[model samples]
Target chain A: MQAWDISFSKLKAGYGSHVVLTDVTAALPAGAVSVILGGSGCGKSTLLRQIIGLSKPLSGEVRVAGRDICTLPPAEFRRVRRRMGVLFQDGALLGALTLAQNVALPLTEHLNLPAEAVRAEAVRILGMVGLSDFADFYPNELSGGMRKRAGLARAIIAQPRILLCDEPTSGLDPITAARMDDLLLSMHRRFPEMTIVSVSHDLASLNRIADYVLVLRDGACVFAGTQDALRASDDPYLVRFLNRDGAGDDAAAGECAAPAVQASLDRWFAS
Target chain B: MPQRNADDISRASPPVKVLRLLGRPALRALNAMGSVTLFMLDGLRHIFTTRRILGRTVRQIYVIGYQSLFVILLIGLFCGMVLGLQGYYTLVRFGSVGMLGSAVSLTMIRELGPVLTAIMLTGRAGSSMTAEIGVMRITDQIDALDVMDINSVAYLVSPRIVAALLSFPMLTAIFDVTGIFGGYLTGVCMLDINEGAYLYRIVSSVTMTDVAGGFLKALVFGLLVTTVCCHQGYKAHLRRDSVGPEAVGSATTSAVVISCVLILAADYVLTSILL
Candidate 1:
């Protein structure tokens, strides 16, 4: 029933010298759906990774519930992680385990509940996701949309106070994406105090579920505020982003292909 | 004239540049070795701390040891039969065909059994371990485990290590027995050597020390192979040579090659120490 606010202070992160996120300072309020929006390579996932403790930031702090997890000892960090859950871009279900077993993993690992109880809880969550009929199936056997739903079921089944979803509806159809957003809204209502952070570029999903919004561009947080403030802002880039316009962007400044490469393509098409 | 970069300007001479080039790879190799050692130590630590490790270990043994039985037996039998035929002919030339049984049994128990069985297993189970974990790493399942506060090493690698430790010696024993039988079929049934003399030579010449030495080699090979495979898979994402599924493929290949080479290298070092 408890939720934690995530705060970032000048966070810098990347692999080796390839910095993906720089000076990303923001507060994702507790008990709110905070959507992180950016272009394909603007460090949304990197920022999420920092919050999840998957990879430590190069410099600065990521505080969950006022404790800077960036410097937490391994044991302490693990305990912090116990209160959090994540839905990866893909389901990331263990291929060796069935859907029921995958959903039950957290309970089995962290709780001393009987096997039947765990199974029952897993099935109940699967039913919540409308996948009760497919509880015995493997992740690979499910469609992409179904997998995402299953992943959500697994992520929320443990009643984590903080849930992070990475690109939750990136590859789904519009209908499925809408359904996912509704499911997320229902989850928020179910646990009113749970902090949910999602990395997404879906403007529709953002409009549907986001109470708070953080927008990144060129490895920097350009906007962090409520959805209404985000929409009302007159920033040219944000306006263009909201309108789905591509004018004056880098791609618009260049030829689609090199002249030589275009000529080669012309020759191929001539064939 | 070509423009010199800052790095080029900093380098003093051709000889120094060559030394630097050589040193870079040497340093990298050392770094890799250190990483593998630490990874193995971490997995071993988790093996002690993880609850219900026996259940996981048993499952891994079924996969790594039981599933690998037929191939090991087939290879072991042929190796012993070949040794039997070779030893008989060589001893016959020396007018000491009676020593054929000692030759076959000793060669098998001391050297071929553990080494060959490990090499076979490296190809079979070790490669599978690398691929399985590599796929999991790329697909984010490992990250999923981490997010759930599950120790990924304990959940994945430690059980395989424990399984390898128990199964290697057992499989080696099976290899030795099957191989000795194969030798009997060759030396006695096919080559018409006296069965009693062959049996007596094996019983008389083979010592408990030899058997223990063979088992020691097997255990060492098992540890090395499993550690190498697990390390490769665990670090597949960090490899400079590839990415995604290609990285997994590269890791699997490296696991098998590295495990086989380490088996031979460690066999030499262990044989010397045990001797």
Candidate 2:
């Protein structure tokens, strides 16, 4: 199935008028894990939001599963969304619910599973994510890694075909980040047809997990190709970003300036 | 090659700049009005899903509404005593203790019960709703729900509005009953008013219209508190400003203020029309 071929053409998204994404055009191959590599304010999350249909694009088309999701009617849009899963940064677990309850939410809301069946499924997913022992715990009771594990369990509960993760490794220690990478890769390996896209500024995590990569800078796609191609290119941006060096030529130093901002207006307005 | 041409850039007046800064969000909010109305309409549509939503709503009423009954009763009794004490003194001076029972029952049932109970909810439930949804916004749970193809407003706001509409009137009824009983207790136990006559006057004087008006006001008040709180919470900035916890505090405070304004305004209009 060509269900995983996702493309965005000149997509623009903003919170109100302060546009976070400006004319971003990119594509990711079917059933491949694509990491959106970027600095803060580079519209990585905004791109994810547009693809997920949370925020409407100002101008452009996002073709996911070969349909224009932005213009789809409500019922159609919901059908599109049902095929997706999202692991929000900060682990987005409901504080009011237990970890099992959080994981069971999608099953309860979208599936025909009986309550007992949902409970059993929730336990299975939590066990898959290494959070089985923590099922009865509330979000406040779990550690950061455990919360992320519970969040992962929730995202995959409905076994969506497309998974979008935002900053999955942030606020995590290196060991935990590596563990999360293993978990993500294992998930991909288990369902080879799953299209997984993750947003990350962490080069190490991206390098560890991303098969196909798109480097976004200032709300536009700078590069979209394989991780090996990105590494081999003489693009100083890829170098500095990968090198984690603060000292570099201005353009390549992972700087984030909102798109279409002129030099004069940029300095003048920030004053 | 060029000196900074600060003079080249013209600035709008301060108020104009502030207005411009606010304009986008204001327009966005205006655009979202359709969504809000649709959400409210969806709550009304729950007349079909009553088996599900009402069961959920009634369960919520048990947890959120009736669980607070003790405090409501306490406030009602105290409110009645104060009204009674004031009415007794005022009526005694006019030698119109006969009118005291009528006055207390009518005001308590038609006005104070709904108003006071709503004010209490503004403190109790309104602030809580703001906190709950605000935390959800900051934590990105709201976004997760959106990505899951659920209308966050319908999922979050509709249930709340339904619960409030159902629960607030029930609470007001209890408040009205306890408040009148409190007045009776004061009149019969503490004062020299004939117990049977006082009870009779309270029962006879309060028209069905008065009680119905109070319940109607309760419904409106409930909608106001839930809608305003949910709105404020929905708009809670993901980034809490350097002004500290001011945003959450302000959301809660705004819920209370907006609820109070809507209730009083609705009270005036409803009383004018219905009474």
Candidate 3:
């Protein structure tokens, strides 16, 4: 398996004039787990959306496996997407399909495998996520944490070169969150060549899994470095965030500051 | 002072307030219409562009057509029975009870069959389609499809549109046939009307042109219902305030209401052209 790197070059993206991110230039190194961190509305998910080509940046480019996906035509873009997998925040599994069927979807859609083979492959992936027994269950039947794991199974079932996860542990108990982080790490070790980019506000999970960290503030990349570098940084925002400070004594003030404060507070309570 | 008072007066005027109140919904409705048209066009384009959707389209036909068969038949039978009873009483007053067969058959073939079938579909299949897709939208399942490199509109929408288009005429024909039979049972057997005259009048009065017109109306109504429902569902997530069950409910209600209105309006226009 070969590794694929995702690079954003001056990416600008948003919804119809309300720019969520601007000039976000960064790279997730090949085969590494890169975690994007931000307060609410800081454009972490926007960056993820751009990287996956779900929505094109207003300008600039997103390069995956050295191809600029922003410029690819629809068919070519789909080909590019086939090499990537995304796990949405709420699983986003098809409610009508059982868990196994949901996991088998990409295989059935993209490959001409026999029905038995697709089912076998789906079951294999479900085992990996520890949901082998729940393969027949619907997404609605699963617990929130189980849904996330099932979503991960679906994401990696196609053996994607890159995996994108949006808030993989946003709504979970501490134990479940830790389990999710462990699962992510184990998956990374199992598929050493698959680059994983996760958008999350979970500090503990980030510390546990992130090899590289990118922090956004006010739609701009305020920090991008290794986890060690982030830990050592004296940047007030980073320090305040890492320390779980709700007071803005060292943080910036005004409109952007309030949301950041509220975000940190929300995370504090969430954790 | 005078200018400011005049501005206030104009702003508070009854006509201006009425215009303001009406303008918002008018604009919203126009925007909705534009969105639905574009969605329908996109689905139509995909109908030609994609060939692998046959399986999904067939499944949709099962859900939209086969599942709704019983309700459509029941509605058709009741409608026909009512028409027969009413026509018998009205025509008997003028000693023209024999024309009851012509009236029932013609009504079933030309007007009631397509219109009533569509109304039933709007309440049944159309609302369900809207709610299903709306739930998908709210749950981010559609976005999940997008990330999976699937064209959400083509994959989720085109099949329903195609299924409805193919199924509506079939359902309408079923409705008309059942309705005519129901009329016969009421008029000939129950009311003791002449059986020979009843069957003969139906055969003579109903023409291919009337049948074709009914089918044409069903086709248009099917397009309108499916397009409106799917469009409503697809756009539910775009609304700023709607979420979860509210979004699905709103989409379903709006799909049924808007499609019903459009069906009736289109019926008038199509009837004028065909008749």
Indicate which candidate wins on lDDT.
Answer: 1
**What are the per-residue Cα lDDT tens digits for candidate 2 across B1-275?**
11232232235677866776678679976876665556457655654543235555666577559777888999999888888878888899989887768978998988999999998988888888887887788778888887766567766777788788888999999998888888877776788777777778887888888888899899988887787788878777743342225676777777678778878888889889995
Error of 2 at A180 (Å): 0.5
Top model number, TM-score: 1
Candidate 2 - CAPRI tier?
medium
Q: Across residues A77-110, which tens digit of lDDT does each residue of candidate 1 receive?
A: 8888888889999989999999999999999887
Q: What fraction of the true interface contacts does model 1 reproduce? A: 0.90
Candidate 3 lDDT by residue in tens digits, B80-146: 9999999999999999999988999999999999999999999989999998999898888998887
User: Sorted on lDDT, highest at the top, how do the candidates line up?
Assistant: 1, 3, 2
Q: How many residue pairs clash in each candidate?
A: 0, 0, 0
Worst 10 residues of 3 chain B by lDDT: B1-10
Candidate 2 per-residue lDDT over residues A68-133, each given as its tens digit: 998889889888889899998878988878999889987677667678999998999999999888
* lDDT (C-alpha) at residue B232 in model 2: 75
Query: What are the iRMS values of all candidates?
Result: 0.8, 2.0, 1.7
The runs of at least 3 residues in candidate 1 whose Cα sits more than 4 Å from the true structure, single-residue gaps closed, are A249-271, B1-10, B13-19
Report clash pairs, candidate 2. Answer: none
How well is each residue in B1-275 modelled by candidate 1, as lDDT tens digits?
12454377466698887777788789999999999999999999999899768888999999999999999899989988998998888999999989888999998999999999999999999999999999999999999998988899999999999999999999999999989989999999999999999999999999999999999999999999999999999999999999999999999999999999999999999999988
DockQ for candidate 1, C-alpha atoms: 0.84
Give the CA lDDT, 0 to 100, for residue A100 in model 3. Answer: 97
How well does candidate 2 reproduce the true complex, by DockQ?
0.50
User: What C-alpha lDDT values do all the predictions have?
Assistant: 0.93, 0.82, 0.90
